[model samples]
Target: MLPPTQTEAFDELPLVERARSGDDSAFTDLVTRYERKIFRLAKHITQNEEDAEDVLQETFLKAYSHLGEFQGNSKFYTWIVRIAVNESLMKLRKRKTDRTVSLDESIDTGEETVVREIAVWEDSPEDRYSQEELRGILEKAIDSLRPAFRTVFVLRDVEELSTEETAVALDLSVPAVKSRLLRARLQLREKLTRFFRRKGDDVFAYL
Candidate 1:
């Protein structure tokens, strides 16, 4: 949900206009502004650093190649995200021959709704673990989700795209995005709950 600030939004228009008019450096500037964010989303979706890198490269390459086709209908970021999402899914298809889960499938609701009270970890895991360790754990937990849930979660929660933007990027309805996001959050909370529970009194002393 990290959106560009007012200054960033102001800066982006000219870059996009110049880039659209065949200015390579302008396009490069656009890439510089968004590459890290896009890479994070790609990594979460592909669940592999190498694949994520490939997706990132391919996304920008395709965008540059087809820059003219980009109408001003959506934000430049959203347009690039659509490309990245497509590239990541293509990579997944090539990597796995079997059918992947559909985004429309029903979520399992065996567990009770995870209370929001528990959702607020007073001392977040990030405070306890080194950056690298926390990243590993987060990646692992996200990877544990089904492809459908994972994509929605990454786009909506991780990337902080609005529900509409997330739905547009993933080609899902807004309600569908909301449904999957809730399920993804619950599933992730359950995993973290188990992890903290295993750490004994030190982590969950407040409970």
Candidate 2:
């Protein structure tokens, strides 16, 4: 949600202020800034396009209605992320009514980890695979993760949220966020490990 430059990031406060003051254009601008990223995050969580679209629409609707309650303690982006994530989680909960385990409360260590160490890739993923292929492999793997782990991975790793920002967005303790993030990375690593084995000193360099 944050812009690359600090100046652009600072601009958000003014936009937020203007939007809070009932400036419709300012609100629209804010939506334009983050709608795609929010949709991706929702899709990552729910793994359903329809649910993701619903979450995206509802997120902005709720944000618009609750602008008065925004305390401005957090960045506008982070606040919106919280709403979006909560909505995505709610969607999953509705679909999983038979399950009794809490999404946030679960200990997600049951997945087996790869015992063999995989070599690091010398080149970026883009150097080896087309963007479409990379995205397909990753999205499919990430979609297999549990909702809680997927949320942590998408916010912390994919969206590059700071640990503190993630904690605030998900309303989790810092320690809990760290633990879940570790589990998420481990899960993703295990999934990706199946794709490229350590044939030599590097990952998939021979190919």
Candidate 3:
């Protein structure tokens, strides 16, 4: 088993200082600390467990190799996340290219469009069950978004990164991030509305 992660080991300040000073252990600890988060971000962006794992591993390795180049301007976690996101985006691009030939057919958008309607229900037994179902469905919906929109939504909404931080991670202007997020959310809403149309009355009755 690996050692404790950096978050579990040193505080961020000490970890940054030690990492800056070429402490391999500190870097390892940092990797341990944020590895799951990195993988999660990758999973969100890539929408594939295998790709996410690869992205996570590559991100940490890259971070290790480039540690010397870190200027210490941002928090270490944020810097590492930037790397992870880029890795995920690159993988997404490659996957899109690989599957481009199969894009002619319009397949069903799947269960997510149905589950998005769960938002209409709240506090009832049906609502609770629907919410649980919606969570899984939302993942599929998010996965269906374009890479840029998906990244923005994950950063700005799911991960709750600030607009500035998300912009930095995505290498977009703040306005660009905002615009993408808005469009993504709207698309999600539209997709979810399909389910809502069928279940809206039931949801309102329960509420």
* Model 1: worst 10 consecutive residues (lDDT sum): 110-119
Kindly report which residue stretches of model 3 are placed more than 4 angstroms away from their true locations once superposed: 1-11, 98-120, 123-127, 130-134, 190-207
Off by more than 4 A, model 1: 1-10, 106-122, 196-207
The most accurate candidate by TM-score is 2
58-159: candidate 2 lDDT, tens digit per residue: 999999999999999888888889999899888988888766325666674554343454556434544466788878989998888877677888999887
Ranking by lDDT: 2, 1, 3
TM-score of each: 0.82, 0.84, 0.72
Clashes found in each candidate (C-alpha, N, C closer than 3 A): 2, 0, 1
Candidate 2 residue pairs that clash: none
Instruction: Give per-residue CA lDDT, model 1, range 1-207, as digits (tens).
Output: 544544345446778999999999999999998999999988888878999999999999999999999898788888999899989988887787786745555555634345643434436556677888778888899999989899998987777678999898888889888888888898888777654443444455676
Candidate 3 yields a Cα-based lDDT of 0.74
**RMSD of every prediction:** 4.0, 3.7, 8.0
In candidate 2, stretches whose alpha carbon ends up further than 4 angstroms from where it belongs are: 1-10, 108-117, 120-122, 196-207
Candidate 3 lDDT by residue in tens digits, 118-171: 444233423544776877677778988876677889888876678999999877
Q: How much does candidate 1 score in TM-score?
A: 0.82
What lDDT, from 0 to 1, does candidate 1 have?
A: 0.81
